[model samples]
Target: MTAAPAGRPRTARWLLRLHRPALIVWACLVVALAALLLALRGPLTDAAAEGWRQYNACQGRGRCTYDQDAILRYKDFAGYANLALNALPVLVAAWAGAALIGRELESGTARLAWTQSTSPARWLTLRLALPAAAVTVGTGLLCRLHRLAWAAGDGRIDTAKRWYDLLTFNAGGPTVAALALAGLAAGTLAALLLRRTLPALIAGAVATLGIAGAAALLMPRLWPAVTLTSALDEDYPNVDGLVVDQGLVSATGARLPIPDCDTGAGCSAAYDRAVGYFTTYHPVSHYWPLQLTTTALLLAVTGLLAAGSFLALRRLTGPLRTAGAAAGTPSTDTLAGAAA
Candidate 1:
């Protein structure tokens, strides 16, 4: 085999050539989703909004007629788009773990690259950086488009998803991009730790999911919530957003959980001490704050994962490193054995 050129630019080109199929698939996915989101932001949303306006205008009148099909179509399209965007992290994780890192290590290709004047460190860095950049750009475009699509429907369509809806929330901000990066890092680390394809793929996906779940659980607390109280005689505060907590507030200014009482009399008795209801929530205005905070958190996790990948690479090639330093370079067979 011809000796591979030594330089970051040439290495990047080589990596791209090796991963062209995966890159093509990724690009296709992004472009397809981007097209869908563009429709949602423009034509689909307009039709749905028109349908809503017609329906609302015909309320309390005879022969109510509206473009119900348009409304339903928009709902279905938006739902699928949201779901696909949310699933991008898992797709990225699986590909990174199984194809990018794991397969190369398993097939001895990584060792071959290392023998061609590419240090294990540079090889790993290129793997992580190249995919990370692609993931960020692709995921970021999807996120922005999804956000715009959702925003175009907001308020205009009566059944449009709220800013707080988990699917919609995850699909519409920097959080998804951050999660994708984290997934790449997680996959890289898992592959390095396992040095096998299947196990690494599973571990990477699970790790990314665990990270996502943790971020979701902590999101409500990441920002300060607004507490709104309403007298019992009135309906609960009519605000719509991500609710942290809701319960009864006693006349003495004490918060209490709403007791489970079915019968009217039972409910009255259960709420006898309560004078009003209180709600703690993050309003629409807090959307950016929550997104930015969660992104910062996932980025931190990604950094740690990248660092761990490097450490695992060091441990895997310890003897190779010492030998290479002493004799200018270790043999390809030794690198392959270390990888195995």
Candidate 2:
């Protein structure tokens, strides 16, 4: 009994040792990204804001004077940072599917571990738990730093992405962190199901993208969107935000599609019957509602995937296999034929 407890810790240590390279890579990624975000939140933001201010002041003065290079530099780095942050889910999924689970199973390493004092269930549990902890901490910190960087640019830099911009939105909140967790779970599940590194890696990455796409489709619907109506002559909503639905509203209050043609004769004919335009959108105030709701959805999916992985692992190894291995008996693969 005492040995069992000791063996569990050893399993964790063994996992860390096996994936030390991955740990180093992940740590370096987190540190580098954090530093980039801090730079964005401070110097880049200040420089860009100052450039905007100078440019605005020189407007209509004939010869414009501003630190254009600073603004361009901020724009370039912000795009890079957001891209990297958003790519975390797919990257994590590939790693988890190929290296964390599938490779071990494919190369017989997992079976060797299962035959030891650490049971298969405990082995799988540790595999999931330790990595999940690391993933959560790394992603959570990145999300916070990204959010701070984004907030620093908001209302300051003229070209800053709005809170509702898809890349910026996900990177700035808990949604991306939850998505990363879902990716890890999906990858683990895929590895267990496929039991092959290449197939699992592909399946995991595709599953994570599917999850992200679903979240995007469901996002606007998660919270009640506010509707704003404006005359056809006025700009839609008069604010920058996520527009759920926008169309012309008829005189009788029925919603209709926007005129197919741009301004002039055809558009005038199409819009003649309409009184004004109406927009259903999530304003800046709805950012948290949308983010939190999406995060919750992703987390729920992650839990389901993790649970499925456990169930799949159980089926792959069979019930008595681990017990037999624990009893110092030769462990026979009950589904050896199936595995082959």
Candidate 3:
């Protein structure tokens, strides 16, 4: 058995054991990323280049033109497509948090670890730190990718209805804000309530999924305070003219086809086209910041829940005998304690 080092708190002794699962998970994540890169890199890069070439060939004809700028935009947008692969890894990570405390409680393992050399708190804290670090770094990478998307695409990346449209879809977005908060809540709830690994794991999964569902549903509403203006889904009745918001030129700006209109009745066809195009005008410039603020609000809610979990974990030194018992958990142990 490994001995505790001199002068270190009992907490230090358990740190190694706590990090064991995290190390394994991180190693697996590395392998997965590597394999995915190897399998997808050639195909994805070629697709990006090909798409760029097509965009360049299609330019300025009013259908869908591609200039060098458009090519660069497509190239950058392609980098974040791997994020569609985000669900699997996220499922793994969300599970890891619950695994930290939940498993120990499951097999009566915590009774062994806690009494042998360390307090439950120390052991729990060490476990949380390892995976939390991994999430932090991993998400950071996602943020970088998002930044490149803006750069490579020359700021023309589609912000509407795109999966990566939200702030959390960027590299660090899921980890730092979503996964991290959910992980903490799941981990502690697993420990304080289930007191057993397998059940705790299930509970954690439910909690994570619940949060995701809730975020998708309610997060948009959180930014009513900061969302400058809502996108009006219903049409306006400027039948003779068009009303627009926030764009120098609309997304599909077409030249006015009607020759000098000496009067309103001159060319019905040209007027109809212009009116239709402008009526459909929906500027996306304000969309990004609105989305970002909403995500921040969701992150705040996550932080509050995680903090509650910390408080819950701190008071218990034993497995929770029932779901009801687990409900009482709460603590102020700090974020580091919920790391794994």
**Model 2, 91: alpha-carbon shift in Å?**
0.5
Best-fitting candidate, scored by lDDT: 2
TM-score of each: 0.90, 0.91, 0.56
Task: Tell me how candidate 3 scores on lDDT.
Answer: 0.48
Model 2 clash count equals 0
Clashes of each: 0, 0, 24
- lDDT tens digits by residue: candidate 3, 1-340: 3554554555555565657666676667655554444333344444455666676567676687444453454344444344533453345434654566666666666655554444555555666665666665654554445444434333233321243344334332443335444555565665565565666666666776666566655544433321112222333323321123221122246434323566666654444444332232212343455446645754676677556655666655433222223443323342223332
lDDT of 2 at 193: 97
Clashes of 1: 0
lDDT of 2 by residue, 27-69 (tens): 9999999999999999999999999999999978999789999
> By the lDDT metric, which is better: model 2 or model 3?
2
- Model 1 Cα lDDT, one tens digit per residue, 215-254: 9999999999999999999867878899999999998999
Cand. 1 Cα-lDDT: 0.88
Report residue 142 deviation for candidate 2 (angstroms): 0.7
* Model 2 TM-score, 2 decimals: 0.91
